[model samples]
Target: MYAYDTITEAVSDLKKRGYTKDFNIRENRLACDQLDTHFGHEDFEIIEVYRFEGPSDPADEAIVYAIEAPSGALGILVNGYGMYADENNSEFLQQLHERVRLKS
Candidate 1:
């Protein structure tokens, strides 16, 4: 429920507050490259989401997610909002299509 002006600021503050996991988009799930672990939707829950838009270009659209795993692991997922994230050919991403919709 917090408003962040930039992705970097949101990420930095969230990490400081314990959302420390760095989750990368994988073909079918989220991966913590540092921990050598893969997380399915069932393994974690979305705690908060932040959406941002460019003052001019549409390409600047993005979203940030605060997430927590059942095992007490925490993380963030920074994703694009425009065609970049839309064209991802991943089943897991497709499943989240409705939930992460961005407003123009």
Candidate 2:
């Protein structure tokens, strides 16, 4: 795994590594409008997780996830964590996190 100084740095490097799509966190799935596709928890796996902490403000906290779908689609999911996180997306992502943990 690589250490990234910022979310932009991690995303840029991952894109270079072929995680080229952008995924949006939906209520129940990850959506990529560019591909006109959406994925459920079973459809994709989290390849990498990079978390960032704010120096002074909690709102700056974020996580960048490298995700790959079973169909070979590669993408990135950038989300804010903690109290400010979206309820639906947070629950959705937590299930994914658990899956990855169990797989490891």
Candidate 3:
């Protein structure tokens, strides 16, 4: 794992490494607006996870996920954690994380 000072820096470096597409949690799946496609938890893999916590504000807590689909699609998902996180999104990500852990 790479060390990053901020979420912006992490995202920038990831994009440079080809994680371009941006993904959002859409119910139980990941949605890429640029591709107008939705992917199930089993459809993609989380390559890396970068977490950032605010020095002052708890709401600033965020997580960046480097994801890759089976079809060779690479993307990133930026989601909030802690108190500001969405319930369904958190649960969905948890499922993906479990899958990755099992594979490991």
- Most lDDT-accurate candidate: 3
Identify the leading candidate in terms of TM-score: 2
User: What C-alpha lDDT values do all the predictions have?
Assistant: 0.78, 0.86, 0.87
Q: Which stretches of candidate 1 lie above 4 Å from their native place?
A: 97-104
Q: What is the C-alpha lDDT profile of model 3 across 17-36, one tens digit per residue?
A: 99999999988789998888
Give the per-residue Cα lDDT of candidate 1 at 70.
72
Q: How much is 13 displaced in model 1, in angstroms?
A: 1.0
lDDT of 1 by residue, 1-104 (tens): 78889888999999999999898777678888767888775577788888889898878788888887777788898888676675553567665554445311
Q: Model 1, poorest ten-residue lDDT window? A: 95-104
Clashes of 1: 0
User: After TM-score superposition, what is the CA distance of residue 72 in candidate 3 from its true location, in Å?
Assistant: 0.7
Model 1 score (lDDT): 0.78
lDDT of 3 at 54: 99
Q: Supply the TM-score for candidate 3.
A: 0.87
Where model 3 places Cα greater than 4 Å from the true spot, the runs are 100-104
lDDT of 3 at 14: 97
Q: Against the true structure, candidate 3 has what lDDT? A: 0.87
Ranked by TM-score, the better of candidates 1 and 2 is 2
